[model samples]
Target: MTKQPAHIVVAGGGYVGLYTAHRLQRRLRRELGRGTVRITVISPEPYMTYQPFLPEAAAGSISPRHVVVPLRRVLAKCRFVPGAVTAVDTEGHTVSVRTVAGEEAGGEPLRIAYDELVLAPGSISRTLPVPGLAEHGIGFKTVEEAIGLRNHVLEQLDIASSTRDSAVRSAALTFVFVGGGYAGVEALAELEDMGRYACRYYHNIRPEEQKWMLVEATDRILPEVGEEMGRYAQRELRGRNIDIRLGTRLESCEDRTAVLSDGSRHPARTLVWTAGVKPHPVLAACGVPLDDRGRVRCTTTLRVEGVDHVWSAGDAAAVPDLTAPPADPPALCAPNAQHAVRQARRLADNIAAAVRGRPAADYRHRNAGSVASLGLHKGVARIYGRRLKGFPAWLLHRAYHLSRVPTFNRKARVLAEWTLAGLFRREIVSLGSLEHPRAEFELAAGSRRHPEDT
Candidate 1:
């Protein structure tokens, strides 16, 4: 008699989910061939977004296509389910998911049963209680936003350079970025560099004419690269005539006018929200034990506390960092890609151990330092108690991520793209029409006289 295969369901295809599934596939290769375990990954997206490269993709440094790995190709052994898990029935070991394509029909949620489950749903953007943020600020997490910001910024240059209306031009030329972490810092720096380079092609626009402002509630920027590197980054940014305002808050924004707590107001059309992210609300619906911060409370071994056959990792899991001194390693892994990758691997190992009736190992990872790309040939990096800045830091930043980006095919393609980009100029064509393809049709229909006027 043949033994039944165990169904292992993994939620979310982000860094954590993808890496976990990757490791699971490799570790369970023999088990899979023997029909001992079946791994199924569920996510709304079929591609695993390499989020760290979003800024570069926005700045046209790296091709956007190369930043995302097709999950189907990467995890051929796993069953890829395309949808978001809406609910979890821990007692029954089943998850309720809604297919993203089902919204049009008001379809019912589909349920899938699993023998073992891994929760890695990741997180959503954490917006502050500020006025006009929802209306004015664009998020920088997804590839769509990155490329959209690039298009919008470049379009702003076109508007400012061609228009004689000072008010319109002023609003168009001003760019404001909120938050000072790696996302905000790298995004502001990269887009500014792209815009500055783009201005060379505009006959009427000077790079200096465009105003750029970075507002951080904290006192510094690029906290991931440590304090000294943060200081150096600020200095370099300021040297480029970019405005870096710390200890400031966004008060409100009325229409295109942004007002700051420091009593500064500017008519800016661009506002990027890169403040931070909180755990996905799905965790709450899962009815699992949560930490004070709402993350799934987990043991050092990555198993959900008080829940049998359930595990969690990544930003969504508040698993204790054993390396931190009774505290949180001076930080709870900083919620970066580095930690997520390592945690996923450890999480997978522990899951495999649990299934085999072996001891589940603890998840302990020492920080290997951090890096941030600040436009072309500019960045900040820290490695093994050593810090680097300027061009060398940027090179290190690229090299490190290139190695981490999944798959040899993608790595080679990215390197080829980088080599070509260094020799040529960035491709700045805007595909904003994709977001609203029927706008023209609607406008034309509204303008027509219902076929009465020939």
Candidate 2:
């Protein structure tokens, strides 16, 4: 009698899940051929987004499709499940997955048993209870949000350009971004640059007329790049006429009006929230040990603490940072793409080692500095104990991220975009109507109905 192959289920298809599955397929190729190992990846999306390029994608620097890598195309050897894992029962060795809507299964949730489980569901936007946030605020986390923001920003220009009311025009032209982390800073910088360029097409709206404000609760921005770079970034932004409000919090955003803790109020149609992220809520229900911040508790080896046949990493895992200096108190790795990508590789190798009855190795890698692109020909980078700013840093930022954005196919396409963009102007067309394609059609249909028919 032949024995059934052991099934390994991996959750999430972001940086961690995709790379882990890719490495596992390469390591267990022979075993896979003999039908002894089966790897299944379950994720909410069919593709993995290279999040570092999101700002550029939002600014129309890179094609949105190029920033996302399709999982099925990349992981032919692994079983790809286009759904989300809602719950995990480690003791029962089963995971409850909710299939995407419009599927043959009627969007029902099903349970699948696995011998080994990898938890890397990743994080979601950490929002506050600020008034009107749920209705007015937009996030910068997903590719959809990035593309939508681009369209929405351009649409605001159209509204401001054609509107007669000064109040409406002011609100439309005023853009407010909360949080000063890499996401908020990069997004604001890129979009502001795009908006400036886009103003050439609008006769009524001037570049200076657009109010670009950045609100940060902290005293500085871009903390990942250290104090010196953060200060440099602030100066550069202010030089570009951006209003930087430090040590300020957004108290409310009711009726498209932003109220800051500093007792200032601004009527803005666009409000982008890139404040931060929290671990996926699914982690809390997975029956796994979680840390104080609601992240999966894992050792340096990337194995879930006190949990057999289970491993975790990425933003959702509290894995100790082995690279931290001896003087610093014990700390976990920062939840960033730099750490997530490396941890995925180590987690994959460790899982393979355990399967082959070998000892697992600890995951350790020192911080490799930080890079931030402030629009075209502008950036700041801190690498190898050296600081770089302006054009040189901008070139390095592009080079570094271009090399890291997954598959060679995507890299080629992105390079082609940059090459073409150099020879031509940036594309700033608005496609906001795509979000509600049927609205106009519905209105037309309704208008055609006679009163007598009603």
The lDDT values for all models are 0.89, 0.93
Any residue pairs clashing in model 1, and if so which?
Answer: 324-329
| Candidate 1, run of 10 with poorest lDDT | 326-335
**Candidate 2's residue-wise lDDT over 1-454, tens digit each?**
9888989899999999999999999999998998999999999899999988999999999999998999999999999888889899989999999886635657557788998899999999999999999999999999999999999999999999998999999999999999999999999999999999999988878899999999999999999888999999999999989999999999999999999999999999999999999999999889999988899999999999998999999999998887776544478899999999999999999988888889999999977899999889999999988999999999999999999888899899999999998999988798888889999999999889787989
Model 1, 118-157: lDDT tens digits are 9989998999878888888899999888888988998898
Best by TM-score: 2
Please report, as a residue range, the 10-residue window in candidate 2 with the lowest summed lDDT.
100-109
Q: How many backbone clashes does candidate 2 have?
A: 0
Which stretches in model 1 have alpha-carbon errors above 4 Å?
Answer: 1-3, 327-331, 440-454
Q: CA RMSD for every model?
A: 2.0, 1.8
